[model samples]
Structure formats: structure tokens, C-alpha cells
Target: MSNSALIERIAARGDGVTGDGRHVAGAVPGDRVRDDGIIIPGPNRAEPPCRHFGKCGGCELQHVAESALADFVHDRVVGALAGQDVPVGEVLPAQLSAPQSRRRAALTALRTGKQVAIGFNAAQSNQIVDMRECPLLLPELFALIAPLRDLLADIAPPRRPVKVKLQMLDQGVELVLEGVKAEGLDAAMALQDFAGAHALARLAVDQGYGLETLWQPEPPTVVFGDVTVEVPPFAFLQATTAGQAALVDAVTRAIGDAGAVADLFAGVGTFALSIQQGRKVYAAEGARDAIAALMGAANRARALVATEHRDLFRRPLIPAELNRFGAVILDPPRAGAEEQVVQLAAADTPVIAYVSCNPASFARDAKLLVADGYTLDWVQPVGQFRWSTHVELAARFSK
Candidate 1:
């Protein structure tokens, strides 16, 4: 057997691959992997910043240096395009968010005896890692972990697991605890006291019926380009502020000076509100609460936005309706917008900005649009989730 081999690149699952197709975990590009499974650190390899890097499951590529981390993010997007046989004119450099910038995250809190553990689950397992130091979460979110453990120990049932979601709003942190039942006045008082002490923007609990607001002195909101949209409990938000700006910039550049734009799957007008200057926007979303937030914000701001609460998967805007707009922007979930892409293929919209979390799905939809008439102009890869394998991108398609 060969004594050693240099890693060529990082594969999709965060493992380093050699030119000869050998996969070595924790070996970054230029690192040498020996037959005995020891990785000799190379130029692109950097010491992981977190003590819990390998075990926490919050980060998979922490072993990779910053330069290599960007490469991995860029390659993942380009590789997905290759898989779909889609050609593009330009693939811009990848943008990776800095460590400890994640604004929103879902963590698990488990109570064992008198102690409670609160953190992300380990990779491929239900066991919680009990996050002590996370480099990916915002300081505001991580600050709650210790306090949460103490609070949960008092209220949570021993050995029972509950999900704790945290989001950074403009005012303060918005906390949501699911699968928790707080009975009697003491438990309720504890929740109120926790919220007041933490200065939480809002605190909601879900005992199974649905999310019930426990404490919200004022309506929680998130600002997107001057407009403040009321945030629903545990609403979908861009993982980082920098990532949202990158995507919004890509979308604005894609639809430059367009008289009208259509934002499909517009969650709380993330793009529509940001890019709707001097133009009319038609925003559609399936989620009722999300659409309400968008509508309320747009209306309160007196912006030129038309919102419709409709599921694009079942009733996508037809080509005839889409033709009314000069440009279309679609930010679909991981499943991608197959039905919308089919309609987009036939629409007369001059430009399209697609923001996607799943590259494979985006590539699939890109294929359909390219075959119809649109030219693949450029793509902007975003590493919002940082060291995780999750890939996201913003691209432009024009006819």
C-alpha cells in the first residue's frame, strides 16, 4: 500500500479526497494522509478553534483553514452545477460568514436527574453534545445556554427532552421552548422571571397544541432594509446578517433597474422589502404567519408590495401572470421550486434571481430554465452555515 497520499480537495460530506479517490476524514487539501490513518497537517490545515469541534456536530469543517473553507464552499456549488450539466458564464468567489455570527439556531435541552444539558445533537445521533463553547453561534445566543440549563433544571421534567430555539431580534433574544408543559403558578412565574431577567424579546412555549406566547412586552421584529417586519415565533430567518446582505446584493444586481419584480416564496419579505426601492413587487408565500408578517410590514411602511398567501407548489404563478413583471426572484426551500421553475421557463420575465439552500435542487431547476432560453449569468455561493456541509447560493438567469 502507498505510505502516504496528499488530499486534493474536500468532498461534499466534509471529508478530504485524494487524487486517487481515497477519502480521509479531517484531512484538508494539501494534507498528507498515511496508510495508518494519521493525517499530517498541511498548509491549508488549521487548528480547530473549538474544543468540541469533532464531537459537537455544530461544525464539520472546523479542521479546515479559512482559505480552504472558502474553497470547499465554492467547489460544492460548482460541483453541483457540473452534476446537472449546467454551464454558467461566471462563478463568483464564495462568501463565508465569520465565526460566532449565526443569529438563529435550534438546540436540544435534556434533563437528567438534577442536571440539564442544552446544546446541539451529535452528528447522526440523538445524543446531545452539551455545547459549552460554540464558535458558530452569536454571543447573544450562546449566552443563554448556561442560564437555560439552570432554568430548565427547575422546570423541566427529569430525563425528558425538549427543543429550545433561539433567535436574535432587534430588541433582544426570542426564545421558544417546545414539548414543555409548565403547570401551576411557580412554573409560570419562573418563565416570566426568566424572560424578564434575560430581557428576552419574546418567550413562547409549545406544549403540543401550538406555540403560545408566554411573554412579549412589545412585538418582536426584524429589520430588512429599513422596513421592520414582525417576527412570528421561531420564524425563518437568514442564519447570519452578512449572509442576508450577500444574497440581497446578488438579487439587486441581478434585477437592476427593473420596473417591477416578483418575489416568490417571500418569507417575511426578506428580499422583497430589501430590493423594492422605486419598483413594484409582488410577493407570494404559503405560510400564513410568514405572509402576514410580510403584508403587515409592507403595508405599515407604505411600500409598493403586493402580497398573496398561496403555495407555489400547488398553484404556482402561471406564465401569463408572471409576464407582467420585468424580473422574478425566487427563494425556495430545500425541495426547490420545481413547479415554479416550469412556469418560469415559459414566462417572459427578463431576469430571475434564485436563492437556494440546496445546490442539487437549484441545479435541477437551473437545467430546466437554461433549456428554455435563459442564460446562466453568474452565481454567488454563500457559506451561511459556516463549517457545516449545508450549501447555499444566489444566482442569476436571464433571457
Candidate 2:
């Protein structure tokens, strides 16, 4: 080991890399690695706030500096495109969701010997880390950990696993407990009291029979733009509000002033509701409950959003139907809407806004679109689940 090496960038798995391509875990860019194998600290490193930083699977890059984290997010999108040999016109700075702003999360709770351990599972393991303090979750969501532990201790069988779902609705917190039952009279009363005391918007439980509403003063709804859509159990919403905003803004800019747009894989009209002003949007979703909710909200608001219940994977919108729109919007699942993208590739829609959580899948689909004469104009990377490898982006493609 003759020459000292300098770390050039962070890798996909949160590891730092030198110019010669040596991987160093917990090392940041501009850091130096001496011949003696000592890592000199660099500017792109941050002290992890949580005590369970190393053990908790909730976060991986907390030790990396903010700039490095943002770089990692931005690089992920670029790297994915490079892998597929897709050319991009521009790549914007990464938009990161702030700490303590996660509006929804799924947690696991296990009760054992008069104690309840409630938190996320360890990295790549089933073991749960009892969260003391989380910098990622909304303050409101974290506040329920203690009370939820107490509630689970009463109803959950000893040494049994309980799945806890928490969401921040416009009205208040909504709690859904699965793998636990409240059949006994005392347990039922306890659940009702817990919901009331916490001012929960709704409380439901599933004891293998499926979720049944235990307490609900009113239906649970989430506001998307000006319309209030009745949310079904565990429906898909962006993990963070800021992340959602960034994605919506990019999509809106991509299809600026387009007369008619088609929102494929529209989950409860998250984009349709926001970007549909003065424009008629044909929103299609596979989920029955989600489409119903979107239709109800659009009808109530007179939003000019036409809702349809169709599985894009099974019966994608053909080019003939897709060509009628001035622009097309796609927010597909992780697998990346191959069947639909094939149709979109040859469509004469002129503009396309593709929102994706998986960069690799997006790249694969982008190649198909590019082959059919669509130009990859620009991309906006968004880091919603911060400190993790999960990356999302919105890209505009034109024919």
C-alpha cells in the first residue's frame, strides 16, 4: 500500500468508494484511506441521531452526510439510465423528504413476557428493533408507539406477532391492527377506549377474518389537491408529503397546460386530482376500492376526472385510445408497466410523464419508449424513504 487513496463517491449500497474502486463501508466522499487501512474522516459524514442506527433496518445512510445522501439518490437515477443505455437531456437535483415527516408507515409488534417490542425489523432480518426515537417518522406517528405497545400487550397473545399499520389522515391518525383479535368483552372495550382517547380517525383489526372496523366516528379520507378521496384500508399514498409534492410538481411541469391527459395506474387520483385543473383526466386504476374512492371524490368535486376500473397489465390502453390525449401520465408499480409502456411507446400522445419508485424498472421501460422514437427529455429524482436505497423519479418523454 504505497499511495494514499481518496474516496470518490458513495456506492449503491451506502458504501464509499475510492478512485481505484475499493469499497469502504461507513466512509464518505473526500475521505482518505491510508496505507495502514485507517479511514480519515471527511466532510460528507454525519453523526447518526438514533441510538439504534446500526441495528435498525429503518435507515442505512444516516451516517452519510446530507450532500452525499442527495448525491447517492441522484446517482441512482442516473446509474439506472446508464445501465440501459438511455440518454437523458437533464437531471435535476435530488429532492429529499425531511426528517420526522413520514406520513405513513407499517410496523411490527411482538408481545413477550409482559413487554411489547414495536418497531421495524432489523436490516435483512426478522428481528425487530424496539424504536426509542425515530427521526424518519412524523412526530404524531412516533407518539403512538408507547400507547400502541400498551394496547397490544393487552390484546395480543404472548409471543405472538402483531402487524401495526399507521397512517396520518387529514382528520387524524388511523390505526389498523392485524394478527390480533379483540373478541372478549374487555378487549373490545379497551380497543374502543384506546381509539377514543387517542382521537384516532379510525381503528380496525384483522384476526385472520380480514379487517373489521372496531371504531370509526366517520369515514377515513385523505385530501389530494382540492378533492377529498375516501381512502381504503392500507391504500397507496406517497410515504411523505414533500415527496408527493415534488413528484406532482415534476409531472405538472412535464404536461404543462395539456388539454386532456391519461393517468394510468392512478391510485386514488393522487396526480389526477392535483394536475387536472382546466384539463380533463382519464384516470384508470386496477384496485376496485381505490377507483371507487377516486370516482366518488371526483364526482363530488366535479373535477372533470373520468374514473375507470381496469387492469393495465391485463388490458393496457392501446395506442389508438392513448393517442386521443395531449399528454399521458404513468405512476406504475415497481415492476414498471411493460404492457402499457409498449402501447405508450408508439402512441401519438406527444408528451409522457412517467413516475416510478424503481429506477431500474423505469430504465428498462424507458429503453422501450426510446426505441419507438420517444426522447428522454429530463428527470427529477425524489428521495421519499430517506437514508435508504429506495429511489423514485419523474421523467418526461416526448415523441
Q: What is each predicted model's overall lDDT from 0 to 1?
A: 0.93, 0.92
Candidate 1 lDDT (Cα, 0 to 1): 0.93
Worst 10 residues of 2 by lDDT: 1-10
- Candidate 2 lDDT tens digits, 89-134: 9989999999999989999999998899999999889999999999
Which RMSD values do the candidates have, in order? 1.0, 1.4
The runs of at least 3 residues in candidate 2 whose Cα sits more than 4 Å from the true structure, single-residue gaps closed, are: 1-4, 34-37
TM-score of each: 0.98, 0.97
1-120 per-residue lDDT for model 1 (tens digits): 659899999998888999999998888999999889998889998888998888887889988888889999899889999999999998899999999999999999999887898898
User: Residue 375 of candidate 2: its Cα lDDT?
Assistant: 96
Count of steric clashes across candidates, in order: 0, 0
Residue runs of model 1 more than 4 Å from their true location after superposition: none
